[model samples]
Target: MTSFPDPVVLRRGSADPQAPLVVLLHGRGADEASIIGLVDHLPTGPSYVAVRAPIAEGGGYAWFANRGIGRPVAASLAETMAWFETWLDGEYAGRRSVVLVGFSGGAAFAGGLLLAHPGRYAGAAVLHGTLPFDAGVPVTPGRLAGVPVFVAQGDADTVIPRELLDATWAYLTTDAGSLTTTWRDAGGHGVSSGALAALGKWVGER
Candidate 1:
């Protein structure tokens, strides 16, 4: 129930508010500016927005307090997600086509948002992060039935726990029944050019 300050956002591409909104979420300990560069590699026509997380961590920010890497504290995640949803509703009251693209911790937050309100988003892309698996969201089977989802994971990712990543994969591909798109490789935790290109293609197709 913490009150978060107004969001800080960096926008690129279209200036039209009616344009499709593509939200880019940074990883833990990274600011909006760190992920804003992704706009250059993503699809055009839509507005690409990168918003800074409310909670400060390291020298940057984090979406929620974590019990461990890729493990969000349920209360903290709930509080921050509520704060973010307020901002999102205010900024985009009637707007549609809101797609979430989140990296690392931000990806978990995005997954929380999508899972908590599956009907609210057009699609979500979880890049290099696990979902907020136990953070109070309903991850029951068919939770994301027919929703568009793009998931990119490195088979050798070391930053997020292996079990969490595997569980996320299992949920997205099978249990959730999402129109899931996946790109898995032997890379590590960071995004590669190939992954970015694949993301662009998926976003364009969506």
Candidate 2:
């Protein structure tokens, strides 16, 4: 497995190691600070940690190399996931439960992690983004059976290709056998207040 630097994380709300951990992953061209801000809108029970992506992109960072919006390079995704796992094992090896919340590119990364290690996270929220299709993670039927997933998307999102979004929905709801909560807004490629509220509620219930 490839090794990388420890992730730079922005933490908020609760420092108790035993408390549930909520990891927030930002989109392409964003850093940990960007997603950490969302903590203000999320539920308060769990501790939140926003992790910076390993690869340097335009002016910010990226989780992995991508061919296009919502499309990741298989090799790069695999390497990065391995790097992330190293950090996770070191910092949270025996944690009770961990949840992931991601947006845009980060959503795909979150999906990759959740799909690759179905037993790791308690739940995952994909906000206004597509899953990591063909990104070296197994997408076979029932891979995520019994997993709780929250999928929020913009009905008119043009940034993520329609086919990819449809595929993600189908995989999560059908192939993966995930217990999914879905929300679609009429906006473009951003999360709305309603979606945030719903995400908070969903995480609270987890």
Candidate 3:
């Protein structure tokens, strides 16, 4: 088993033990604190936790090593996913719903986790990120059948490769068989106000 440093976790929202859990994943070269603001923008009733990725890179941290931006290395992703699941299972030791919201590189990690363990998460939000394609895990058609997924992408996002983003959009909306909701605008690589509002609404309903 690969050993990793302790996860740095930032928490917000309801502290109720029975509340649902939302995991926030940050972009590459960013820390957990970078995405903590999302908790305030999201709905109530769910406790939100932002977990720092285990791998250090670019003065921040990353979920896994990648072949290129938005493309993860298969072995690296598998290792980090295993480490995250171990920590999550130990900490969130209940049947409470757990949702994943990831942005950029973190978005790919979020997609990897859901595709690897479809039944484990309540839902997933892919924000400005791509699905980890060939870096392991199954992206086979209908892998997320009946699952709820919220996706938002910038029409002009250049940070992540265009091909990967298109592929992610295509897979999630069609072949993945997820009950997907998508938002696209002329914005660039960052989150937009519209996307945040829609996410809050979606989280509230789900």
TM-score of each: 0.98, 0.96, 0.98
Clashes of 2: 0
Whole-model Cα lDDT of every candidate shown, in order? 0.93, 0.90, 0.93
- lDDT string for model 3 (1-206, tens) is 56899899999988887888999999999999999999888987889999999998999999999988888999999999999999998988994799999999889999999999999999999999999999889999999999999999998898999999999999998999999999999999999999999999988877
Model 3: runs farther than 4 Å from truth? none
**Candidate 2 lDDT over residue span 27-142, tens digit each:** 99999998898899987878899999999999999999999889999999999988887888898778788999999999999999999999989999998888898878999999
Give lDDT: candidate 2, residue 133.
84
lDDT per residue for candidate 1 within 99-144, as digits (tens), equals 9999999899999999999999999999999999878999999999
Pairs of residues clashing in candidate 1? none
Of the pair 1 and 2, which is ahead by lDDT? 1
